[model samples]
Target: MSASSTPAPQAEGQRRTRRRTLALCALPVVLLLVVALFAPLPYSLAQPGETANVLGRRDGKPVIAVEGAQAQGRDKGRLMSVTIAATQPEATVRLPDVVRSWFREDRAVMPREAVYPGGGDTKDAEKRISEEMKDSQHKAVTAALRQLHRSPKDIHVKLRLGDVGGPSAGLFFALGIVDKLDGDGAGGGLTGGRTVAGTGTIDADGKVGAVGGVPLKTQAARRDGATFFLLPKSQCGEASAELPSGLRLVPVGSLQGALDALKGIRTHGKVPSC
Candidate 1:
């Protein structure tokens, strides 16, 4: 038989193999694109269910003005806010500082095991919560704020969800609550509007948590004209390592603590206009 007439099994097999290889390579690429476009990964491991309440209220009503509904479906905009005319330091201290410290240091300190390395799937748990509960607390808080601002009900306490990686945001969150209560405008009439930048996580009891990526965040905040940068007391030393010479690292531990820290910054640690 002529060469052309013979069946080419080897050639056909090679072609099939090439097609399979291409498909396999394409799968991961497609998945990565989806993660990037639709749902990004969480910055920290403090998943959704671990802690439920994030807002605080005063006088039987929400003290902060939140726009939770607006934040819905917005991945990065997820945040919690509290409405209070004034921050009460005693409320936070009422809880054991040791308990607070445990949470503060848990992520970085937890040891990994064989079954669930890196603290028994703790990272995985946090990742799941961050993904499934995208901006949930932010929406809840915003809705509550709107309701209280309009109706003035007897709720008296509020909390909302917030992001993780960006601990510096705690400063902004704390200042927002303070401005809402003390500022001339409704909810303090403070218009941060990307003017001032901050980092650190705020506890319901009003303590700030240490955050990673201090240098990058601080540089970004400074570039945006943030006069003050809020940092967790634990992370303060770490943050100093990355702080730009001109940037201010306002060390804080809790929401109430942040307010206290801010007073010190406003009085003593004022940064020169950039």
Candidate 2:
């Protein structure tokens, strides 16, 4: 072959090799972008939500006020409810967002099935949460009245938890009711001028049941300046592992146990710890 023709062929071959190498390198990047934009992840992200004061008012109404009983005492400390911010099943979560959430300390990456069971829609999830909240309120009122040895007919307990939905606030709801009805009396009110945050599902029998998102709840509590956190005995380990510094975790199996712990806090008595 002639030298000029040979040089042209060699140059063309080098160009083809470079093009192939470039295409191979670009393939992974293109695939990653496509997956990050189009592919939906089966997981959801949960973050810490704000803490609400159960003893305070929401939208101009007392959250836990009684009509018959005299609700006295200044705002000594807060009775807060911890909440978790989560994604709905119907929402699209890309891979990049999931990866980012996984690395964020304040965010928790969990299976979508774990957050929304049965693959239900947002409306279905809201309905379930509303029902759970109503059930929790009823159980909380009953438990508080029973603990106070008061008849439901004698006392009218009105809970004004506006727009907040979940059974996790049950424990705090009961405590708020008791605090309002008891009016800072000895053995009646237990807040003791200290901020208290808690989460659990309560029953009319005063049994405390475990709830999800304890770690996120704890973070919320800590951010809200809570000194103590009350939770179910079953969730102690998980909560303890993620509990922030300067916050104490107290485990209770029953409403009475919770009251006792609060009483101990007030009187500087020995309190149960997780």
Candidate 3:
């Protein structure tokens, strides 16, 4: 072959080497695309969700209706419960979704195992949530009655919650009950005409316990126009770090402490801070 017509050996080798290098570089891109599209991530996305007023009506019925005692009028303030959305076990989460969640301030990325332990199914998660809700409601009612020094037999308390399940509403539920019972008494209502939002697990003894999703809950409370938020004392640090502007965070270790704080709000007294 003529030297001009034939490709040089070194040039051919160089062309092949360039092609190999391009292929090697493209391999990772192709693999990443595939994984991003199809592979399930080990983490789940959590985001801030809706807030509901415990004292408000739902489905044409009062959320917290009292029978036997004089039903108090609605307070000017609101007691809200915040919720967070978490990925279910059966749902598949991709890397792109996780990456998106990481950039969103209201969204949280958590390990799948941490969200759904023991590979539990969706039904199991629902059942667990329902149990927590029921327990919280019971505790809240009991605590409120105890704090008011009222007998459960003399008053009937019915909680009407629609499709909401979580223990984080316990504190607000207790507050709502107390406000309903007190109704502008000497100490004034628990809310005292200011939007109050809170999240915590309450026991029968009125002790407040920490719950998860404090940061998201704080954001939700602030978005809902809550002037004050009550959180378990143990979660004060998390709440303080993410405290929204124009919202006051009060850390309470017990139900009485929450009441005292609210009274302070109403009376313009010095209130406890987180």
Per-residue lDDT of 46-149 in model 2, one digit per residue for the tens? 99987889888888888877877666545477899988889887888887888788787789988888776667889998888889899999999999889889
Q: Which scores higher on TM-score, 1 or 2?
A: 2
lDDT for each residue of candidate 3 in 109-200, tens digit (9 for 90 to 100): 88877666556788987887888899999999999999989999999999978888878788888888988888547645667788888889
The number of clashing residue pairs in each candidate reads: 35, 0, 0
> Which parts of model 1 are misplaced by more than 4 Å?
1-171, 184-195, 267-274
Output the worst ten-in-a-row residue range by lDDT, candidate 3: 183-192
Q: Which regions in candidate 2 have their CA more than 4 angstroms from the true location?
A: 1-38, 72-75
Model 1, span 137-191: residue lDDT tens: 3432233344225322533323333333212244454455445434323322333
Q: How does residue 197 of candidate 3 score in lDDT?
A: 85
Give each model's whole-structure lDDT: 0.41, 0.85, 0.84
Better of 1 and 3 by TM-score: 3
Candidate with maximal lDDT? 2
What TM-score do all the candidates reach, one by one? 0.40, 0.84, 0.84
RMSD of each: 17.2, 4.4, 4.0
